[model samples]
Target: MSIITNIEDLRQRSKKILPRMLFDYVDGGSYDEQTLRRNETDFDALQLRQRVMVDTSGKRLGRSVLGQSYALPVGIAPTGMAGLYYPEGEVVALAAAEKWNIPYTLSTLSICSLEQLRGSTDYPFWFQLYIMKDRAFTESLIERAAAAHCSALVLTVDLPISGQRHRDIKNGLSVPLRFTGGGLFDMMLRHGWWRRQMFAKSKSFGNLAGMASAENSKLMGLAQWCASQYDPSLSWDDVAWIRKLWKGKLIAKGVLNAEDARHAIDHGCDAVIVSNHGGRQLDGARSTISSLRSVATAVNRQAPVLLDGGIRSGQDIIRALALGADLCMVGRPYLYALSAAGPAGLDTLFTILKNELEVCMALMGIRDLSEVDETCLENPRYFSREY
Candidate 1:
């Protein structure tokens, strides 16, 4: 096996180890994936101003979000059915995050239940919600999160309707995985992944236990479930309704504009995660980084502003900090690590990123994350224009 030193290494390994359907679910974005490509490219366009001759002995990569202290600012972003990456991947992911003193967000569509995960980790984590058309079910989920001791409620506002991820349809990705002749061949090639998946105790969406009991539930699938559940009428007014039910910290995810960012604050969101759903929705939309500065400016420290999408490395995390993001939520990178390797892979990924981030900061003469502002960039004034 090759010595893994970076996220790309893990990604390549994951691609080889997992089946095509599962790998594509983690890797491929929606439609043409223009915004997906742009997410990374936009971050690459921004350059850091390397500084020299400064004290660098006491740099610590730490931050507090929602009254919780993290050893690093990067937290696991919610991914649907994360357990498919490895056997009980979400459980392992949470355990790893707890070990590192970071956060793990459980997706509404997770294969592990909040109650189950609550027992696995010592510390509390965040929960991501997609307001269902069934308000009763939505309220039940909120109640369940509270019961699970989830610290914050991450209200995902972007996905009013499901985006057409071309890969999913092409791969015929579904739960219980109907295998084509080629798929069977592919599975034979990747027996290790198949074996792990077969042994997974609660693979049928643990969060949605008893929700799909029919014999053909696997063919019915989560996407179809999402289509049926997601309320298209989800508006800012719904935030008030949710706010009434959830007293914990509320973070509005998927805000791409300043108006919406500020409006999230207006609707009593504790934080705003600037995302385009990792470019899995709105394929032609602006990259999260491109829109991040404006959203950050709009929130203006009234609430924490975070960025998600295309954060493949610690250098990318540094780019986000310079662009005015308070914290960054990582999706694909963690999944890559968890899927490629096991618990150790996740820990190694975190270590590599930590080293990269600190080195990047130290080279730029930054001793703390607090010092990481717009000044750290070559074009600090690039975001000076009105939104």
Candidate 2:
């Protein structure tokens, strides 16, 4: 009920409002979480070059990615079960993104279906695909996204198997929450949160409700079905197959190395997101920021390279752009903001980021995104080192 001014404030508020299981699902990372911790720490390691007494007027944050212009370079990275954080959360985030004129990516596991999202907003949003063991269902998802008029297909190449998050297992996290006595007690303590979610539009996974088997529609059943759906056999050949099926711009979302990035370009992707699934997929893999320069160098502009993971502020966004990222995507920060307030929370979060970015750009003597490059970093030598 207080003013949520920053991402940390939103995160703390989200912790207070959301149930432990739901909060952990968004906040926790896999295994030892070395990669997760490194993701943010590495950004701190890169310092921005500060310039003074320059004409900072007429500054613009707008940039185009995959041929679509945005009010800002940042996009809402897809986070599944967003509705669990707040009522109809994904829809709220999409609406906020549309109003802000930036992209909002809908996860295949999102609580809101593509159709529901399409019905809610006239703006075209990107769709993220998670290939499943059920090839037919995977194809069907692509078809559905196309029918919904998705602007791009973000094929998440990682996550052949869900990483083991300690918190999720300990908390007994499941959809349509299987409440233990402790969990119920926790929910009871947050009566306001309970009432809002209880009254909110829908709790079921909208996209998978019809496709999921009856047995898979229950609490733990959904988890089991989701785990079983991940196909370990997924390969580059599958990406080619998907390319043949999808006519829109294709973006491979989990590239961490140059070889993989090159594969994405060779397979005809329009962009490659240098990401590690926010360190949720691989625990000890190098941070996305650390890998950005090498992957960007390899791709050599064959396709635009975007970075996702540990992007918490506009300063971080600028650092990514300096390190060779064409754009950036944020996941947890926006979710925390949405959970803290709602649509208004998102509006505030975007405003804060935009303002911070503008201020940073002005300080760097840069007036536009095109002016941002490796030269904007205080220490470009760190980025020049071989990965």
Candidate 3:
């Protein structure tokens, strides 16, 4: 608990607790991992403006996204193997989101089924759908989400083909973890991990296991399923069809280009998240933060704009908001927090972020999140001189 000071601290603990394969699977990126590094560093390039003599007491972080008010504009992005991190990782994350009064998006690949989540949690959470070749199955998933009373449908459009992650391939990362001799030996060294798994018997993928009974008793690897099922030919027409099936808010994720952003708007997407699947897809793709302003301006701010990828601190959140991202999502940071110290760690993360944001707002001389707008950022003079 004491070691959990920042996201990096959680990462270190998770690295020690989880097996090498699992840690690499979550932390590593595709190919060169250039985009991954950029996702973090690009946010650093954006500088914030500080003003003096403005009151910042009692500043509120509450926000509304797609007609729903949130205690914080931040939401947990969908991660596939959350269950692997700690038993029922999705449950832990959703529970945390519920406690924080923010939206929690369940991944299409989640181990915990929508019903399981809905039954356990009171409020409706958002659902992220990955279009598959089987239109019937995809439609069925959307229908199930609807049945679960999901408030929003997030359709990920970029991963037509899975990115080549060297670490996953080398480590043989799968859902029902294939325990090799090395893996078992590693697990043995991690006495704490073994104790938790053996005693709690929480290694099961709660949501997905029952849905597919044949693989229920056995471990099901997410990468293998994704490789087999992710539809490569998915297009805008699919989005239109899914939108019709889902009556609630529809958001398009993996949007990087302005043209695609416009297309998302054309299909009536309530919002579009400018993400490269957290650098899990398109290895050298532009950072979501770098692409935010153009995409937001391209859509003419007509729809709510959300950004994800490389958001580690409150300053990064502020930078995104100042650059036109109405809301943002963080993936690994929350996942790390969950893996390191479970619910308490996550609570610590939320408190730390809230405090960091308050300090930033106060230092920037703003009393409200709404007031911390694009004007608070000083666009590079060299870049602006061309204008």
Candidate 4:
């Protein structure tokens, strides 16, 4: 195999190794995918000022978020079905984050249970919770996180209803994958991936299946189970309620509008992520980068504003920082790494990004991430006027 040089290469490799259904699940976006394409393109439009003859030595990537130190400002966004990417990919991903001294957030919908990761690593990683119609189940999950010693609770408010990804529907992407005769043939074609995944251990949605006997439960598939549980009527009052329950740093994910940012702060949220659910929900929603400036301004620095969507590289992370995000979360890139190369692959991807980020910062004449701001961006002549 050729050496993996960058994230793009890893993505290509992942595509080759993973089955079509699973690869599309990780890489594809909602219907039309316009927002998905824009997420990456918008970052390219921004230009960084290059400084020559600047002192090159002694730069640090270390930073803090929510009163905790991170090796860098990047965190892994929670992705469901990570195990399908690789056998026990969540464990490998979190373990990688622990080694790097950054936070790894476990998705509420992840296949791994809180118990599975509780003693898996020494670091107390953060936990993400999606408010469900089952209030008892949601509360119990929060209790589980607390019991597992999670340091923060990230409440994802965007996906009240799952977005319609046409690819997923066409590919029959569901939990406990229904392999029709054709599907079995497809699985047989990707024998290497199937062998590693199937032989390592039994696969189940560890977190959900733990709550009840999945075999006897009414929810037959992942889509059905997720649809029945997500609380569509969630309100700010619920945020306040969760605030009292968590007693730790609270981050509200999926905020793209300024009004929501202000309300998140009012409800005592410590941070508001400027995200469009990675373009997975609301296909036509404004790019998280486009909406970020207003969202950041509305919050008025009262709360840390982070972003996640369309970030594919270290340069993208820098672009978000320049635009006023306190930090950035990467979803699909790491998933690709985990799927393509396992723990070793993730390590390679992180190494390439860290090197590239440092070089970009040095060339831009910035000593640290704190030095990045609006000065590096050009306001388009057509967009200078207020909307």
lDDT of all predictions: 0.87, 0.88, 0.82, 0.82
Model 2, which residues run further than 4 Å from truth? Answer: 214-219, 385-387
The global Cα lDDT (0 to 1) of model 4 is 0.82
lDDT of 3 by residue, 3-69 (tens): 5667787789889888888788779889989999999999888888988998788898988888889
Deviation (Å) of 260 in candidate 1: 0.4
User: Predictions ranked by TM-score, top down?
Assistant: 2, 1, 4, 3
For candidate 4, write residues 1-387 as lDDT tens digits. 248888889999998888888889888899999888888887777766778788867778877888888888788888888887888878888999988887788987777778888867767788889888878888988999999999889899898888889988888877866766666778778877997988645366766764434433665665577667777788999999999899889999999888899899999999999988878889887888787878887888798898998787778788788777988888888888998889988888788778888998888777888878887555422112212
lDDT of 2 by residue, 1-387 (tens): 347566788889889988888888889899999999999999998889989888979998898888889999999998898887788888899999999999999998888889989999889999999988888888999999999999999999998988999999999887767779888888788876888888878787777875546535563555577777898889999999999999999999999988898899999899999999988988999999999999999999888999999998899999999888988999999888888889878988899899889889888899988988888987865756565
Q: TM-score for candidate 2, please give it.
A: 0.97
**What TM-score, computed on C-alpha atoms, does each candidate reach?**
0.96, 0.97, 0.94, 0.95
| Deviation (Å) of 357 in candidate 4 | 0.6
Candidate 1 ranges beyond 4 A from true positions: 213-219, 383-386
Candidate 1 per-residue lDDT over residues 167-225, each given as its tens digit: 98988888756779777788779977887888887776777666554323663765566
Query: Which 10-residue window in model 2 sums to the lowest lDDT?
Result: 211-220
Descending-lDDT candidate ranking: 2, 1, 4, 3
